[model samples]
Target: MTESQRPRILIVENEPQASEILTRWLEAEGHECVLVSDVDEACQQLEQDGFSALLADIVIAEKSGIELVAKAKEHDPDVAIILVAPSEDHHKVIKLLKMGAYGSVMKPLDQDEVTITVAHAVERRRLLLDSRQTQQHVKEEIQARIARMGEREEHTILRLVWAAECRDEATGDHIRRIGLYSATLAEALGWDQQQVDDIRLAATMHDIGKIGIADGILLRAERLTSEEFAVLRRHTEMGARILAGSEVPMLQMARDIALCHHERWDGSGYSQGLAAEEIPESGRIVAIVDVYDALSHPRVYRPAHPEEEVTAIMADGRDKHFDPRIFDCFLEVKSKFQHIRKEVVPEGVPS
Candidate 1:
């Protein structure tokens, strides 16, 4: 962040030395710090407004850190909380994180880890706020298009697409590619025109269940904790449930793609471990393109890899994460996929 945008951090630690250490570390990184020895001071400071994050001990002057976290969240749900605790308090840290703390820095803290964690927490806070603003803009635009499109089925599909795009990693460009790329692959596989058309629309809704995930978990800037990942993985099942029992052929295909897209060809995937041919053909097709689009785009944790690097990863996944025969077909139609990648508008830019 710029100097004008330095984070105003609230530090709640009872120990004088630890408090000083935190202040020095954070301030050296150009952050503005508010130091308090007890939860009461923290609460008072919190009431004054302008804290971008809360850095607190597991126990702050006889009060539980969890209380301060809750209070801070109430004040500003977007305020990132970084807990300071001993390794033995891993359970406490986990619970606090689940309660909306950004993350924790195990005590006897490593300077790099402390600084890095705080930086990441602060960045996440900013990104999530920015993303929410962007999503609102996107939603308004989507709603306008939906209103003009007319017809119940088209409206339902676009609304579901809106749900997926408004929340998670499904960018407008990403959604477009999923449909076109999946359709391209299906056509190359000698599928009938109807099959290709169904796969086109169905593939875009594969992650619609992401609407059910919390913004904090979905927008996290670092690797997720196991508990967090468990929560995230449920999007597949949730998507399936959302699309379930639709008598329409497209919705049925969508349900299958959502549920089984994450299942590995070698049986290492989740929600259910169907392997090889056991994974439905719909899931198999969407999985390859979903991964392709994801890897080709910049994500929260990493930048987008070049096409060659992305292709290498896909090649390595052959007969493992992807179906071998379909993989070969994708290679054959590689030029068409390249064209789709170029044709879509750049992600995060207004389209």
Candidate 2:
């Protein structure tokens, strides 16, 4: 390489004589060099300045050269690290390489071989940096596209929720509260951010099956007859089928919740009669929030129940209607549920 093309190398060595020899040899090869005698000084230089390649001794005072390699990579992931060790330290060389060192040089150092290795390491670092930059650019583009798609999906789901709301007597505020209630419960259950957000959106669609029901059945003001109730129960499976085969993860969760949210922990309540932990966790979570929101808000057949009565009703179903652990978690975050309902459902509103 020409002088202008020569790479800047940081050489970390404890021995003053060895450091001088290595620096002179690298400079003779037209490379810029920074010589530091210990890992601390080497780390300082790494943080304050940029270098194309790092040549560090296998042992520095109170620290292993492997430590320098890790620190250097953290400072500049593209920086290539070469360890200087004895020929008999073959195991150490192999270990360092596995830890992301570029290569190793054995002592007594051969100036020509070291120069060639450093040159190759510098070139390798350049290629890695280029590849990383390209990957980051592509990742940014993909995320941007996904963001736009997410917005469209969100709008479409809201429209579907609105359509379902129109069919049932539940107000728009009921759906909003369900979303918030479910999301809060999910977070309390230690779900990841994406899962929490997905539940927030998917929980609103738990009643979407009502869209498939006849208006006469969905809008009935009185108690449903045994036959009418049997038909109404099919809405769970109907909602599942409506949301089935969706490639979107949120919609997939929505489908599961729609299908199994009515299922009981003791194996007694649904289209499939799944019991205990057999139900999907998403379904279990939605089941609690769905019922809570329903009891707290008015329906065509009944007015909203008081919060105390609502809590007592839910408490009675802890082991049967709801997952025991989830019900306990709900008790912990019950205030958050009340806050969400109050914030979303305006005062004087039935919800």
Measured by TM-score, the strongest candidate is 2
Off-target runs (Cα >4 Å) in candidate 1 are: 1-156, 344-351
lDDT of 1 by residue, 110-166 (tens): 899999999988888888778888899899999988767634554466555865667
> What are the candidates' C-alpha RMSDs?
25.8, 6.5
lDDT of each: 0.84, 0.84
lDDT of 2 by residue, 77-150 (tens): 78888888888888878877888888888888999889999989988877877787889999999999999997
lDDT of 2 at 346: 65
- Cα TM-score of candidate 1: 0.54
> Looking at candidate 1, what is the lDDT of residue 241?
97
